[model samples]
Target: MATAVLVLATVTTGLMAGLYLAFSVAVMPALARVDDTTFVRVMQRINDAIQNPLFGLVFVGALIAGGAAVWWHLDRGDVRWWVLAGAAGYAVTVVSTVAANIPLNNRLDRAGPVDRLADARAVRRDFERPWVRWHTLRTLVCVLAFGCLCVALSVA
Candidate 1:
């Protein structure tokens, strides 16, 4: 059971890290080349689409499984610290997302349609930089968590 939990946590965190990494490397850069209106509209659509069940399951599941992995390994002297580190790393990922990304997303959402905006560039300007920065931080944290979990699995 503990192994299963660790695997789930590791895989989910890895997947999320990959998602964010892709955005930082590819998506955002690609979006950067587009006009402000296109960028704003595309990003808004992406934010809306990303809130669905599959993404939610992975996002929330990583935290739950990571926590469980930490708890389950607490008494297992060899792997406990690694698992705990994994949990801590994932917690940072969650905190950065909630503290920084979500608010930016919400603000972008509330900005309404890009086509209707008086200044679509202003909307994009407000959302892009901070969102990318927070996302990069989350990606790094999540990758670290995934690595810790992988080490725990090997040591366990």
Candidate 2:
């Protein structure tokens, strides 16, 4: 049961890591090449689109499963420590997302459509760089969590 939960945690974390990796490596960079209007418009659309239930499930599930795995493995010394580490890493990812990225996303979303904005460049300036930095942090921590969970699985 513990192993199954740990596997679930690892898979969800890996999925999230892949998402962040995709944005970091491909999506953001591609957006960077476009004009401010296009960038902001596409990003706003994406932000709105990503609020769906499926993404929320994996995002929150990763944390919940990681915590459950830790509880389940508490009696197993090696597995407990690894699950703790993984859970801690994922916790940071979640915190950072809420603390840093979501606010920026919210601000951008509130800025209304790019076409209606007077200065799309200003909006993009406020959002893009900081959002990317936070997202990069999320990507790293999530990947670390996934790796730690994978190690826990092997040791178990």
Residue 61, model 1, lDDT: 93
Q: Give the alpha-carbon lDDT of every model.
A: 0.91, 0.93
Measured against the true structure, the TM-scores of the candidates, in listed sequence, are: 0.96, 0.98
* CA shift of 79, model 2, Å: 1.5
Q: Give per-residue CA lDDT, model 1, range 1-156, as digits (tens).
A: 989988998898888888988998899999999999999889889989999999999999999998998888889998999999998999899999999999999999899988789999899899999999889899888888888888999999
User: In order, what is each prediction's RMSD in angstroms?
Assistant: 0.9, 0.7
Residue pairs with backbone atoms closer than 3 Å in model 2 (clashes) = none
Query: Which pairs clash in the backbone of model 1?
Result: none
The C-alpha local distance difference test score for the whole of candidate 1 amounts to 0.91
